[model samples]
Target: MFLRAKVRKKDGKEHRYFSVVENRRIGPKQQKRMAQRTVLYLGEINDGQEAAWRKSLEVFDESCQRYSTLSLFPEDREIPAEASSSIQVKLSEMELRRPRMFGNCWLGCELWRQLGLQAFWEEKLSSQVQRETVPWEKVLRLLVVNRLIEPGSEFRLHRQWFDPTAMAELLETDFAVAEKDRLYRCLDRILEHKQALFVHLRQRWQDLFAAPFDVLLYDLTSTYIEGEGEQIPQARYGYSRDQRFDCKQVVIALVITPEGFPLAYEVMDGNTSDKTT
Candidate 1:
């Protein structure tokens, strides 16, 4: 890469404009060639110090090799340019925060966008109050992505997970959207459209995969509750999957496609058998 001075003869005056140019190599190794391209145009010589400008950019590029980012904003002309112009260039550095968590958040957000979950939530959520007050879809997607990457509860997400993550920058929103209660409320809103969401995702997956979603798969799981008769009737003692036969528990059945797209789910009594479910 190098700086180029373009000569412009306007009305018989020799005017020169500067541009940063780089050579791009393409094609097979045997047919490789350098193609010059303009990277940046530093228009006309307004200050008549084009030499100093070139020296500054060259020095800036050199500094990039040494430091990725500067810690704080500094006054212009902090570094002297040893060029043949009476121009003392001005430059300032801004501290850039690129958390390693950005890549994980970015992949999650892109997947959420590709699934059209954002648009779906915006359109399918039935409550007018929720649509106006909370970004139910965005929050829910964030929760899912965070769970996949970090595996934490809503409380952990709001209090700890949000702080070090690049979610704020990626979502272009502040801490209010990641509040604990707000994240939990997103679950309540989404459950209202659970069946519709499943159907929607199945169709979306079919379109994405470009194949028929054939073959149904069923799965059953059970979890026990530790509470002692807190007025919950469905909580019954059953053959515990975890061998906690004495504790109250509940059964859940999930129906999914061979492509791993969930179609429906059922929550049943604790003693419900796999055959009955």
Candidate 2:
């Protein structure tokens, strides 16, 4: 069994929830074990109940309060320190209380806001053509860059940012829940525009490192998705890199220079041999 809890607080209210799910174990002992996850909804509680949950959560709250969250906030250009301190502290407290050490959407939004995305967002909104603004792109780019910097399951990506209302508010957008299909679509778009994406990345790299890319390295990866579709030029069955040949997958080549600058990428049928090039 697994337990899950959600806590929410809003309009001076608190709500608490607890749930459990069961799973089978296949380890050396091969026995069943209980898995528990909990979410607390502190937002629905009245003042009195809120106080009680706060009191009940005193240990965690204190851990948050005692943390020096000021250092975590980004330094904005020419902004008065006092002006941004409160927001920074609140964001820090939220981060400190998190159960894991992955990308925190609230923190990411706070940092992006401090980096002047808000002004860019407003500017783009006012444009006649409404061209894509640098800030919006930066935010998305940062999110993707973080993924490449530290790859993790899409579930983790969803869990870390998909449902955080405050984070959406900070980003001046809605928290459109990042479903797997949506994520795949976004990634596919990126792949379609891979050349332009690499050009932008290369420019940023040159500016940051004052160098150019050399000695491109290449490798391929495969992942089998659910369901069977007609094999395309880039889809086939082969040595399942994931050790599951029952399904067909596409092999995607990821190329990077010796200096770690990405050069190019391509996709082919899973049966396509990495040994080919």
> Tens digits of per-residue lDDT for model 2 on 38-78?
33222333557545444333221255566221222333524
Worst 10 residues of 1 by lDDT: 67-76
Model 2 TM-score is 0.45
Error of 1 at 180 (Å): 1.6
Can you write out model 1's per-residue Cα lDDT over 39-96, one digit (the tens) per residue?
5687777554765655444434374565232211224545446534444322223354
Best model per lDDT:
1
- Global CA lDDT computed for model 2: 0.52
Which candidate gets the maximum TM-score versus the true structure?
A: 1
Candidate 2 shows a clash count of 33
Give each model's whole-structure lDDT: 0.74, 0.52
Candidate 1 residue 51 C-alpha distance from true site, Å? 22
